[model samples]
Structure formats: structure tokens, C-alpha cells
Target: MATSNSRSCLKYLLHLAHDNLDFRLPEITALLALRGKPFHPCENFREKAPFWCLNDLSEEDVHSIMTRSICAKSAFELWGHGQTHSELKASLLNYPPENMSPFTHKDSTYRINVYTFNKTLEFADRIKRIDALEYLSFEGTVSLKSPQHIFCLLEDYGTDPNNIPEQPNYIYFGRWIADGQRELIRSHSVKNRHFIGNTSMDAGLSFIMANHAKVKENDIVFDPFVGTGSLLVACSHFGAYVCGTDIDYNTIHGKGRSSRKNQTWRGPDENIRANLRQYGTEKMYLDVMVSDASKPVWREAALFDAIITDPPYGIRESTRRTGSNKDITRPPEESHIPVSQAYHLSDIFADLLNFSAHHLVMGGRLVYWLPIYRPEYCDEMVPHHPCLRLISNCEQTLSSHTSRRLITMEKIRGPEEVDRLAHLADLRFSPYQGHNAFREKYFSGLNKREGEDV
Candidate 1:
């Protein structure tokens, strides 16, 4: 008979979806750190400390990875990680433990994005595993289930199999990464309200919020520049209450702001409304207000457990005005008239850091994305603050229209602790550092004695 301790030694199967090859090094590192394991980018999975069976887009490759994996999980909507399409196709073809008999103790967990389900279900059905499919979490559209349709599929159409397990022991709603959660937050509309100049949140914000959701619950989440309340919407969806503030009144009313005519233009703009209607919540109350993110008027709400926002990088209307009437620059076409001086891009970061320090609760995570104007500025800006400590520089990315630097910091006190953290941040931002070392150190601590099982 197998020993109780030995039986509990789980074989975790990890289905690594492809992330953009550009800026996901930090994101990859953060996942390993959170799991308290070391991650190696190469193909040898059998002997690794975490024993992750990673494969990209191909079903054949996924079958191969699962055949070798003991306990498996799936992650979806991975974009641009593989170098070629052939490589991606090879990855997915490797799933469902290829040609093996389904066993009673077969471990199962599935993670997917909302949009990928139509494709994912086809793959999930192929896995002939005999035991429970315990965990189910998604980052895609939650409204797709259409309860009636799901009932029909399960009961009448006989879609879901009889042998499959009933309910998951633990389930999470949102993306596998924090950045996915942030995007959902950014896309949200405040009671069907639109925004004047609010655009989408960078990819990393979505990753960070998803990670934060695992640890924080029943906490008030704050997004000062709520703009249509994307971040607030994500937090609310994840079972957390949210409070948001934006200066654009039109954003709170769903009416297009006069300055930002493109947001509410009735022509192509019908897409946003259509998508919301798809979720059956185009008229949902967002609980957001028209207030500046720099200065929030939070009411009876408790201190925020976390703060995640994409502060304008001077690419939007925020850049149009600065201190006085001096003109900064005009579009080449508008040489006839000059506009107000745009704010120095550097000042925006300075203000964002200061504003976050005031609102975020101690020990609460603050994940924000910034366009890198000057890398050296991060150095000068970091150590000056006493209340905030730059925890991790989750690498950098060239996001749409801007090269972004993702900085994850925590609110804390004590000058000495913050000082030490500054040195750590410096190492993290340095090329070829932080990620591997952090994972190595953490995994070693978790696995101090060899042969002593987890």
C-alpha cells in the first residue's frame, strides 16, 4: 500500500500557454516565485523541481506534454510566444495523455480564457482521464454559459460526459496572470458610461491584478483613473468590491465626452455596446464617479487592499495642458494655431508614485505600468520615496504605441527596509539579472534538503 505522505505528494501538471516573447520574462519569473519553484526555459520537464509540462499552441504537442505529465493544468490565450506557427501547432497536438487508459487517480485541472472555450472544450473531451477535473478558472467572457444553453448541452445534448467529475474543489474567475485581470478592468464601462480620454490598460496590468486576486479577497480595490471603470470591473468580477474615480464626467454617464469624440461616436462605436450586451450587463452600475485620480474622494469605503491603474503617459489628453499658457508642440497640420504646453513626461511618473503612496493600504500591492521615457529616472525616482518600496521590476515591454516598464511595488514604512529594497530594485532592472536568481534563491529555501519531499 502507498504511504499517506507519499500519496499526498502531488504531481502538478502545468500547461504553459504562449505569452508574447517580448516582455514576459518578468511575468514568467513572477509565476515561478509565487509557486515557490525554479523555472528553466528549455525542454527537459521530467526531472525539473516543478515538473511542469509546457507546450504552446498545438494540440498534438499538448497531448505529448500531458502524456508525460502526472497532474496537469491548462492555460490559454497565449499569444506570440513561439517563434513559428509550426512550433505552435506541434504543441497543442500533444495533449490528453495520448492513447493511455484513463485512470481513477488521474489528476486534472483546466485553465482557459473566455473566448478559447469553444476550442478548449474540443480538447478537454479528448482527455480520457478517469478521475476528477478539479480546478476550472477562466479569463474569458463569463456570460457565454447562457445557463439554459449549458443545461441543454449537459442534460439534453449529452455533451459533457457521464464519467467526468461533478464540481471543482477550488475555482477562480479571471486570467492566469495579473495583467489579464487588469485588461478586464480597463475595458469596463461605468454604468454604460464612456470616457473622454481613457484608453486600454497595458498588458502587464492584466497580469498583475490576476495574481493579486489569488491573495486578496473582500478587499476594496481602487483605480483612481477609472475611465469607464475597467480595473474596478475586473475587481468586482473577482468577488472584490471596487472604488474608482475619473475626471471625465462623460465616462460616468456612458455619453461620449466632447473632447474625446471617438469614444462615443455612434458609428463603429456600436461594438462596445454590443459586447456589453453580450455579457447581459451593458447597464450595470459601476459605482464610479467623476473625480481626478490624483485626488480621490473615497467615501465610507475602507482603505484599499490594492491599487492597479495605467496612468496616462502623455499620449492622451492629459498631455495637452501643463502649468501655464505656453505652447509645447502642435501637430504638423496645426501650425496655424498652438495648443497649451504639454506636461513634461517625467512629471507624470513622479505624480503617480506620490498619489499611490497616499491611497494604497500598507502591505497592499500597487501594480502600475509606465512608458519608459528615461531608464535612469527610475533610479532617481525610487529611493526618494520613504513609504513605497519598489518590489520587483517585472522586466520591460514594448506595448502597443509605447515601450512600457512594469513596476510592482508595495506600500510599507521604515526608511532602512525601503533602502535595502532600492538596492534589490536596481539589480532587478539591470540587464540579465533578478529573475533567475530570485527563483533559484526562493526554490532553494523551499527545498533545503535533497530527497526530503514537498
Candidate 2:
């Protein structure tokens, strides 16, 4: 029997998808962190590469990672790797014979797959490559349709379409383990979803945010600025109890203009809860309310395990919060609700950070997007709080001069009075404080070109 000791110190090969390169590391790291494992990449680790060899992980750990990773395509148990096929053979030979016996045993049925990155091999050539591996004695019966065990020979042709190399830059051989949850992206696509908004989060990105927050089974997840509960849908799929609040009554009630091209209006059944029900995650649905994020109504306690949101940046949706020029001490009556004025970009972030600090459990994460005018943005401009420690800031460029950063932060300490008031008193947020400041900056270049035409 293959024992835990036999799996110890064995390296794992991650076959990551080429897209969403920026979000890959943090997603994998956060998933591993949930399992109490630190990321230990093997030698010559390239963060941008399609393949990553990881050490200090067991087969179970790899399985756990594959369950949650959207940025990854598949995973394998790395038996050998080298700069060349000859070197790969030497490495495979050096591998302990005892480790090879279990898979190559006479009773087993197996098959080999040849996967090449950045290049494709002809069928005959692929057959020739597999035939070259005859040096490794295999006593198992060949089974192509359904195999008990599978091995793979992976070739890394340097990632350049223009300059195709005659030889592969690297080669890896491994035992197939598990595939990642790439199917989730297609299954949970917003195009197929029951409810969607103009700025509903993309299904892939929603799952990435949930992974970044380390959302797990039975965990409570919240989205303060929820729009059709896209992030909540992703969180609920991972077995988390999901709820959210939106200031837009139409959105909260799912009774608004349809974002679909041909659809005139949403049906009565159209709602966030219905979205969960469509995905068979209705049990994970808590509730969504029409409430202001700035003036949070939740009790003063850590009630959520993760807070994931995508605040409106005044492009697809307008940013507004309840208030008026007139100063009224008491609450407004039911007859006349307060008018919503422009909520500043700076204050939106300030309120979000403060709210997260107060509401998220210790070590729980706050994942959200921060819009940036690319030229004016610096690391210092990322909002900070004493209670929340900034984790990762990844960019998804929108235009030549504008991009939004996905920022992940973990709550380290409970809020202090000093921490709650920091953003209000800080001088750093002055640049984008104006309600239309970011909006104006985002459109300046476009307007300039239009004026040039005029």
C-alpha cells in the first residue's frame, strides 16, 4: 500500500491556465493557506509560467487546491523534470524504484498523455515521443479509453508565437491527479444566470474573489454593494452562506430594467435568491436587503467570515448614498426618505475599509476592486486601515489610462477609535476626493479625441 511517508516530500506540478495570470498566485496561496500549508515553489520558479512545480505538499493538499482553483486547469504528481528529454530520463532513473513500483505493477491499467505548452505536436510525432519512454519498464496493460492510472509527458516550448524553438525549453513527467474547477466558470456564467445587472461581476472573477477571501463551507459571506448578488452566487457555490445589501431598491428587489439586449424587463421570479436556487445553492442563500453600505445597520459585532464587493466607479453605475444639504438631527419619516447625493470615491473606500474592519472576523478577508487613474496611481494611494492588513493588489487594465485593482486585505486587529477616523483625517485621499474626479479623469482622453474631431 502507498503510505503517507511515500507521498512525503513529493513535488506537485500545477498546469495553470494562461489567462488571469495576475490572480493565479494569490488564489492558489489563499487556497493553500486555508489548508495550513505555505506555498513552497521548487527551483527556477517562474510566476507567469503555465506550469509550476510545488514542494512540501501532499497528494491530499493538491486535491484540496484543485477543488477551489479557477486559475489552474489541472494538477499532477511530479515524478521528474529537466531542461532536456535526456536529462528528464536521468532524473526519472534517479527517482527511487520503490516509488515507481506501485503504478507500474502488473495488475494496473494505464495510459500516457503528451501535453505541449505554446506548441502542438503532430499525432505521429506524439506517438514517437511516447515510444521513446520505453526505457522506463512498465508492466501494466495499455488502456486508452478508461485507465486506472495515467501519466503525462509535458513539454514547455517558450511562450512566444513568433519565435518557435526547435527544442522544448523544459520537460516534465508526472502522474495525473485531479483537474481544477474551470467548469465552474462556464456553469456559473452570468450569461446563463437568472439575475444579472449592468455591472454584475463576471462569473470567473467572482469565483476568484471568493477564493481570495478563502471562503469555505458554512462560512458567512457578504457583499455590501451587491449588484444582483453575483459575488454572493460564487460564494454560495463554495458552500458558504451568502447575503448582501444594496442601496438600489430596484436591484435589491430584482425589479429593474433588464441588462440583456432583447429583454425589456426582469420577471417577478428574477432575484438573487432565485439565482441561488438556479444553481442548487438555495440552502446557502441567507437574504439580501435594501440598505446603505455607508450607514451599516448590522449589530456591532464580527458577523461575517468574508466581505467581498465591487463598488460602483461611476461608469456603468452611479455612486450615491443617502443624505442631503439640509442638516437634520433625527431620522427622516416614512413619508419622505432622504435623498441620495453623490458619494465621493474617496469616502466610498473609506467607509468600505472601516466597515470591513468592524464587521469581518479576525483574519477574515476583505476583497474588492479599487479604481485607478493609471498615471496618478501609486501603492500609497491604496487605502489602509489599522485593523486590515493589505494582502494583494492586482491590476485588470480597462483602458490606456484607467485600470482597476483587485485588493485583498486581512483583518489583523480589532478596530480602534483611531483606526475608524483615519480615512476622514488622512491627507492621502485628496487627489480623488471629488465625486466626478475619477469619472472626469477616466473620460478626459476620450473627450480630448472627440474635441480634436470637432
Candidate 3:
């Protein structure tokens, strides 16, 4: 019975998890964009707040976002909200009854849940709070076990735990819509995965990277530094056709010693293809191979829709590429032996960006992590390319002195758009020179901390 005017003005509420605060906006925005919707926040929106009010989104849009979101815990169809309980009541009264009657009808069963952020309430107080909502005309029977409709009264007690307030800083009333895919974190955890390397990405972060890249069904996704194909697994779950390349032969063949405790050698079936089968996404697996990221293996055409990967930080893994010392004599072709030299962090990022620039289709995205030394970190330190535009850079701190940033870039123009000579002439287009010393700075900080402890 809702009027067209009222339905058009309806707003949705998102209750986001506090962890990974920096990645929330980008994740939600990308999800909304997937549905051809723009991120339109209501007035006085706070990015850091646990609750977010979004306007101009349909119920279908909300459902779509919930199906994919890992940062958002749950979403709701907001009925009312205000700075105080009394104000909340006033706001609820102003909501159109025609829009509310279907769920609150006489035959329907419903339940009211009280959720408080940053504070815990006594059982008695929680009961009192729910009982106070009697002002709304809910003709439905109270069914806690299985309700047709669920309403929630959420209270925000500010983020500071030390200075808890007597009353909530804000209150919201909404009908619960759907919960996010946070359960994927536990279900796909690397600890439980069949094939994992020392630096296998966390399942939660791998999914987040796929989301940031806007990986969608049937899209071809690739990872150049695919170690154990963690990123590929996340993309395959989203219905993408995934493939990747790595320089290590043992890793590509899954013939190395096992990383798990009490295990010696890897099982014969312990491989990237088997990982996709474990998650029932084997159909989406294209292939993986042993190839250096610095070398061009693919044809000179844009082949990938998205590139999501976690490059080595040179901590647990060594950054090496196929190379030989300039002074070393070359062996005969028949008796040639493969040799590897150090791959500088700066050059790694440069090759990654350049590779993505040529191989990613126009509008395709590349999402990867860049290690940073906190003391010398700057925006300029992020590698850039003319054909690709920087989208988002989110920081995930590892320790007091070291952190890695998740960098997302979208290819806006094809390689033909820029002159080859000019692109190389620009110093900014090169890899950040400072990154070459990151390994030194990282260890220096660790040594300084050790000295302090003594």
C-alpha cells in the first residue's frame, strides 16, 4: 500500500564491522556499482560509524550487496532513527503506515531484537527497551523462534570504551534484511585449506581484494604473483574464470615440502586446481603455470578483466626473478641451468603496473598490496602508470613500523592512448625508488626495537 513518492524516498541502513574500517566504503561502493547504483549517503554520514544510512537504493540492491559484502555485518530497511529515544519515537510516527502495514499485519509473526554497540545491557533493561516499542501498531503475534518479520532497535554508544555514556549517542529502528558473507572467513581460512604457502593470503582479505577489483561472474581474472592461488580461490567463488602465474616451479607444481605442521611433503593432489575443487568452483578454474611476472607470456592483447594479487613483502618470502649476473658467463644451450637474481621491490611494482597496463582490458582493475616503511611512507611512494588510474589505497598495519597498503587501480585508457617515449620520460611513471630501501628500513626498525628492549 506504499505510495510511489514514499517508496522512492525510502532509505536503507548498513551495520558494518569495525575492523577494516578503511576498506568498508570502497567495498560497499563497488558492490553498489555492480548493480548500476551510485553510493548515495543520507545527510550527516560518518564513514567510521558502525551504522550507515544510504538513500536511493532499492530492496533488491540491498540484498545484492549483502550477498557479497564481507565488511558489512548486516543491512536493514530503516524505519526510523534519531539522536534520542523520544526523537526516535517521533521519527517512527512520521513513517508512512501504508508502507509498514504489510509486515505488521494481524496474521504475521514478528520479533523485536535489541542490539547495543560499544555497551552491554542487563537482561531486564533489554526487555524493558523492547516493551517500550509498544507505541508501534504491531498486530503480529510475537514469535521468537521463527518470525516472518524481524525488527531491530539498535543503540550506538559511541566508539570510546573508557568514556561510556549513560544513554546512546544515536538510535535506529529497522527491519532486518540480510547478513553479509563474513562466514566465508572461517570456512575458507588458510589454516584449513588443502594447499597453502608460507604467505598464503588470509581468506577474508583475499575476498576483500576480489570485491575491490569488482570481480563478477564469468569475468576472466588473473594473478601474476599467484602463490598457492589464494586470490584466485576468492575470485572463483564469485563465478570468475581464474588463472595465474608464478616463478617458482615447485609452487606451481605443488611438489614442495608441506607448510603445515607435522607434514613433510605435499600431497599429489595439493595444487591450485584442487583448491578450486575443494570449494566446488572447479568449473571456474582456467589454469596456473610457472612463469615470471617480469616476462611477457601472454599475447599482446588485453586478456584479463581483473587482476587481484598479494605480492611478496620480502618478509616470509623471497622476491626473486629469472636473471643472471652481468659478469657471469652463459652456459651452452644444451647444458644451461636456470638462475635467479634478486627482484627489487621497486622493479616488482613497476613490472606489475606495466603488465597490468598492457594486459588488462580497458576499465579492468588491478588490486595488489604494497609494503611500506611507516616512517618514510608517502602518497608519492605508490607506483603509478599513465594508462591506469589509481582508485583506492587502504592501509593495513602490520607492526608499529611496517604496514602494507592495498592498492586498487583501474585501466582507463589503452596503451595506444599514450606515447611510449613520453611515458618512459616521466619519472613519476617509474617505480618508487624509495621502495628499494624498504627491506633495510624494515629490519632497521626491528633492530632498534630489540636494542630498546635490552
Candidate 4:
């Protein structure tokens, strides 16, 4: 009986996927932020819990979220919930009959399903659970194959799989509204991709980064250290115009050795634009250039709407830039390539923060990965700039002692706000004071796992 405009009082239950626990809240929060809405979680809020109850959201809002969310599996209209079956019956009975009337009408066809988290149930047990919901008046006829209205009985047996409780810690009854975009993970997998490399990002995380960047239709996105254009492929899927720059000419031009096994050389079409074309978003491909990220080739202007990338941390790809020890007074010949030098992880982040602050439009975002030496990673080590505000920091652990944090920041003030003595001019470039400091720390963690002396 709730009108579309009056549905804010209705609560929605989100069934989030079990993986990527750290990224879920930020992804949902960012998606909600896209609609000019704040994340309003309800009682029994646990960061790692599979089910989350959110308040003050309309059904339309839920659909919009599910359309873009890779973290969530499905969403429901929370009709009633309780800690026990008897309590759940009481809660369901207490729900206004007017709200139930529309879906439970005699002329409507409906089906009831039972879902349990952290536990598997026999078919009989699932059927028994569904039959228990007979306490609620259902005037509709049962239609298992195709139902006009679908309802669910969800039970939470707690998160401990090794110690699942005999009874669910909680119970919920709701109308199934929509499912999330989780299929994108498998469909856009790197294994099936046309263009790939030694370090192409996984599909699910690419979508998550695009979601965190809050990329939308017509938005212009840029990647500073794009490898195989995985991030650009993700951004273009969201209708954003995508471009990038990488120091490696072979990578940018899709030449040289192929990343795929048994293939000695890359195909002529194995390029970033082709990757976007593989996903049917080729029209959104702007272009990628073989330019150094440290020395940005763009004119002095705020052109990008969102900048999303994953810089090399020396695990698979070496981080180098166009540079030299001795300064040359004259420019080299047009075809001559400059000698390369080490691009320290510390300076990488420093340059990234500064570049993002000046290049991103106001309210635009800069989403990138910062490798962490887990033991030494304090929040202070996240580089800062006057014009950018840290938004969300989520971790994706690679090893026992090594991980990378996905840091999302937004342009709060214009580039003009950056002033000498007010911002980072006096601050340390990063906690990684020297090139060896970062490189050694990163490799030492890996060495520790291999039983080698650091």
C-alpha cells in the first residue's frame, strides 16, 4: 500500500556476497551516494554479515543499486523479520494487511522459497520451512515455475561455517525484488578476454573499482598506469569514455610478446579498444597513449571526471619511468627513446595524489591501489593533498604479510586552493622515504614467506 514516493519508511534487506568483505560497504555506500542518498543501515549491522537491513530506501532505489552492484547477490523488500519462527509469525501478522493485500490477492500467482545462510538444508527441510509460513494469509494460488509474485524466507545461521548453529540466529520474510550484477564477474573474466597481460586485473575487482569511482554515463575516465586496459574496460562498461597512459610502448600499442600461453606475439587487434569491443563498449574508448605517468602529457587543465588505475608494485611488472641520471641540454631525436630509471613506489603515490588533485574535476574521484607492507602500513602513509579528500580505503590481501589497499579520494577543492606552506610541499613524499625502502620492504615480505633471510 506504500506509494513510490512514500516508500522511504520501508526497509530493504540486502543479501551481500560472502567475499570481498572489506569492499562491500564502500561499494554500496558509493552507489547510494550516486543517487544523492546516504547509507542508512539498521540494527544488527555487522560488517562481515551476509545480510544487511537498510532503512529509508524506495524499491526503485533498490533496483538502481542492484543494477550496478557486484558485491550484492540479491535485494528484497523486508516485509518482516525476527529472531525466531514464532516471533517472525507475530511480526508478519503485525505487518499492515494493506501492504500484503496487493501481492497476496486471490487472483495473483505466487511462490515461497526458503534460503539459509551458512548452512545447507535437505529438500524436505526447505519445504517444511516454506510450509511454516502458512500462518500468514495467502489468498494467491501457488505457482512454482513462474509466479507473478515471489517471496522468500531467509534464515541466518551465523557466519561460522565450522560451527553452524542448530537454529538460525535470525529469520526474515520478504518479497524478492531484484538481483545484482554478479554475472559480470564470470562473463568478463580475464581468461576469456581478448587482450590480457602478466597483470590484468580480475573482472570482479575491476567492476568494484569502477563502482567505487562512481563512474556513470558520459563520464570521462583516465588511467595513469594502465596495463592491458582492464580498468578502462570496466569503466567503459558503465558508459564512461575511457583513456589511459603507460610508459611501456609495447603494452600501449598491443605489440611484443603475448600474455596468453602458447602465443609468442600479440595479435594486431589485441589492444585496449579491442578489449572494450569484446564487451560491446568499444564506442566509449577514447584512446591510450604510450606516455610516462610521472611526466603526464596532458595540458594544464582539469579534464577527467574520474581516474581509476592499478599501478605496478614490482610483483609481476617492474615500475619504471622515462628518465636519466645526467640532464641533457638538448632534446633527443624524435624517434629516440629516453633511458629508463626506477620509479619509486613512494614517488608514484606522491605524483599520483598531486596529479589527481590538479587534473580531476571538482567532486570527481581518484581511485587507485597502494601496496602495503602490512606491518608498517599506518593510515598516515596514505599520501595526502590539499584538494583531495580521502573517501574509502579497502584492502585486498595478496600474501600473509603483503596486501594492496584500494584508496578512493575525491577532489574537494579546486587546484587553485593548493598553496605553498599550506599543503604537502613541506610533507614527506611518503612513508617510503627511498626507492630501496619501498622495494626492499615489498620483496622482504615475500622473502619472509619463502624462508629467505631479509
Compared with the true structure, the alpha-carbon lDDT of candidate 1 equals 0.40
Q: Which ten residues in a row have the lowest lDDT in candidate 4?
A: 417-426
Q: Provide TM-scores for the models.
A: 0.47, 0.96, 0.96, 0.95
Of the two candidates 3 and 4, the one with more favorable lDDT, higher being better, is 3
Query: Which whole-number lDDT from 0 to 100 does residue 323 have in model 1?
Result: 31
- Model 3: per-residue Cα lDDT over 1-454, one tens digit each: 3433456357899999999999999999989989999999999999999999999988889999999999999999899999999999999999988778878989999999999999999999999999999999999899999999899999999999999999999999999999999999999999999999898999999999999999999999999999999999999999999999998889999997999899999999999999999999999999998888888889989999999988876778888888776766656365223578899887788788888888999999999999999887888888878889998999999889999999999999887645333335667645467787788888999999999999
Error of 4 at 314 (Å): 2.0
Model 2's C-alpha root-mean-square deviation from the true structure amounts to 2.0
C-alpha lDDT score of every prediction, in listed order: 0.40, 0.90, 0.90, 0.88
Instruction: Give lDDT tens digits, candidate 2, residues 97-119.
Output: 77778888899999999999999
- The TM-score between candidate 3 and the true structure equals 0.96
Better of 1 and 4 by lDDT: 4
Instruction: Candidate 3: give its CA RMSD in angstroms.
Output: 2.0
**In candidate 4, what are the lDDT values of residues 88-125, reduced to their tens digit?**
99988888777777788899999999999999999999
Clashes of each: 40, 0, 0, 0
